[model samples]
Target: MPELPEVEVVRAGLAPAVTGAVIVGVEVFEPRSLRRHDSASGHFADLLQSRGVLAAVRRGKFLWLPLDSGRALVVHLGMSGQVLLRSPGSDTDRHLRIRLQIEHPEHGELWVNFVDQRIFGSMAVDSMQPTRDGLTAGYSGLAGGATGADGLAGSGLGWSGLIPSQVAHIARDPLDPGFSAPLFLAALARKKTGIKRALLDQTLISGIGNIYADEALFEARVHYEQPADSLSPAKGRALLGAVRSILNRALAEGGTSFDAQYVNVNGQSGYFSHRLNTYGRQGLPCPRCGTLLVRQQFMNRSSHLCPRCQRLR
Candidate 1:
């Protein structure tokens, strides 16, 4: 599954390619990929035709496309969905689920294709009000834009800003500009869950998945089995800082690519996999303590860690 950084990279890649381009047509090859409107076949075509993309934004893992109309197109890439911008006469991949052709006067014609082999990706067009209400009502402020920072501060939530709805459900987002040592420590202090499971909770901290969580835990020299609430404030702060550093470095390197399926918009795999400390490096010598890195399954996900380095509390 593409996590926050990967999705952000995808959004950044598509911004220049599709921004301001007027949608000339919409084609859906896999009907199930369109989650909104049972009759998405005709509805998508009608809504997209002649509508210009006003802005492209990402809230959590979902890409938001605000069109000329009041409606917004929400896209979830799911497991292996990718948005590719192709030039005129370029061949569309057979795995394409949705394609939107944009008529750009100067750039010639551009095709934005959503390709997903797993069929887990989703596309939906709906009113912004319902979307906002649904996000706020159902998931608190953790889905996208949900709560006002001032109100949150007044309510003793201890933070501010346009809190993405996912934040309410997860902990802290290392990539978010508002991330702070104190905030991260507070979230960590409240959980008795395993460190790895705590890291995966979107309400605890946003953007981390199985891979990065293991990598971050390894980098911090913390065992995944450690109880989140048992970590000292200093250790929590250290772990928070490590998470930021690791993720920032990964983003700088275009995120870790596991296979050909996880390439970026340019069809390039992330270079960070080479710098991995423990992830997918079972039996390899640990960089810190020279112990063999170990892999174990917890909650149905593999966790890589160094036993000597990551001592249990």
Candidate 2:
């Protein structure tokens, strides 16, 4: 699955071409790609046609485009979903799931193709609502909060800006400009889970998965099994900083692409995988302390760490 940096790379790549472009037509090559909409594929295509894509936005791992009709076209790139911007007559991939023909007076004709080897990625039309701050509905202001009747909390009345309803409970990522370190530290002190487990909790802090969790822990020199509540405020802040720094660096490198499935909008693979420290480098030397890296199974997944540096005490 693509993490925050990977998704952000895609969002940035698609924004320039898709924003301000009107969807002249939508072709659903695979009906399962629109399964989340729960409507017929034809109706799904009709809802998006002729609507302008205001901007390509992402919150954590969820991506959406706020359309002219005040609804968002939510895109979930399940496992192998790739959104590619191709030339009008470009050769289509065998796994192309959905394709949108867009037109821009400035940029001319283009096609946005959603290709997925696995059917995990889905597109849906969802209602947009305001953030809890009541200031604006930009991605920066959106933060995770209580789950409401519709599964996300809000003012329950007229909204100001707009965000997809499904993303309401997703906490702001560390990269978000509105992210608060003090607030996150307070939340971290309240969790009874392990530090790595707490980091993976989307409700606590969004955009972190197992790969980045290990990297951040390696940087913070904290063990995965350390109790979350036991972390001091300083340590919590350091962990958050490590996360931000790591994410920023990965974003610069176009995110870590270990296989062909994860790629940029142009179908180019990321080189950050070569820069990874401990995610997939078990039995390798730890860059910091020269200790042998080890892997352990936790939550039915693998966790890599330097036992000498990240000892659980």
Candidate 3:
């Protein structure tokens, strides 16, 4: 699954290429990738035709493209979706699940394709309401009452009004400019679940998945099985810092690609995989200690950690 950083990298790559460019055509070779409505195939094609891309932004792991038609193109990469940029007239590959031909007077023709083999990716054209209500509303407090024009009603698991009190039960976004360390600690203090499980809980801290959780826990020298409530305030702060550091580094590296499916728009694997200290390194010597890294199944996901480095309390 593409985490926040990976999704952010994809957003960064597509923003400049598609922004201000009018969508001239749309092709959906696989309809299962559409998540919002049954008629999305036609609606998406019609909405993008001649409509300019105002902006391409990311909220958590979701990608939002504001269009000139007073609507937004909302996309979720799910477990294995990727967006690739191909020059116009370049031979289209069979993996191109959804392609949009964009034309910009200055930049010439560009082809943006969303490719996925698992059919888990989603694409939709919503009148900004679903985008606002679903994804943007999650950041309303951070956005300071600035709601996008599509007028989406805020609705999702653990999402409510713009007040922190309503959103207090929700997890803080590590990428938010106003992410509160104290608030994160408070949330951590309240959970009795394992540290990894707590980190995975969107109600505690949004956007973390199996890969980054293990990486962050390894960085903090905290065991994944450690009870969240038992962590000290300082340790909580360290964990938060580690999460930010790991995510920023991953974004800088263009997002990790464990398989061929995750290549960035330039068709390159994320560089952070080379810097990984613990993730996917089972049976390998630990960088900190010579102890062999262990891999275990937790919450139906594989976790990699150095048993000596990440000692359980």
Best by TM-score: 2
- Residue by residue across 1-313, what tens digits does model 2's lDDT show? 4788888888888888887799998888999887678463337887898998877777788888878787888888876889999999899887999999999879999999999898888888888877755433334222432122222234442222457787777787787765678988998898888999889988788888888999999999999999999998888889999999998899889999999888999989888898899999998899988898999999999999999999897
Cα distance off (Å), candidate 2, residue 210: 1.8
Tens-digit lDDT track of model 3 for 1-313: 3788787778777877877789989998887887654463357687778888766755566666767665667777888888889987888766678998999778989898888878787787765433222334343222442444434454332212222221234454688654567877887898898999988887667778888999999999999999999999889989999999999898888878877777777766777788888889999999988999999999888999999989998
Predicted candidate 1 versus true structure: per-residue lDDT over 1-313, tens digit per residue: 3777777777777767666679988898999998644453348778778987755666455666666675656677888888878875688786889988898666768888888989888777755432222222122123343345323334322121222232234343566544555766786798888888888777667777777888889888899999999998888888888887887888788877888777777777887889888989999999988899999988987889999999997
Error of 1 at 65 (Å): 1.9
What is model 2's C-alpha RMSD? Answer: 5.2
Each prediction's TM-score versus the true structure:
0.82, 0.90, 0.83
Q: What is the C-alpha lDDT of each candidate?
A: 0.71, 0.82, 0.75
Summed backbone clashes in each candidate are 19, 0, 5
True-structure lDDT of candidate 2: 0.82
Ranking by TM-score: 2, 3, 1
Off by over 4 Å in 3: 37-42, 129-172
Best by lDDT: 2
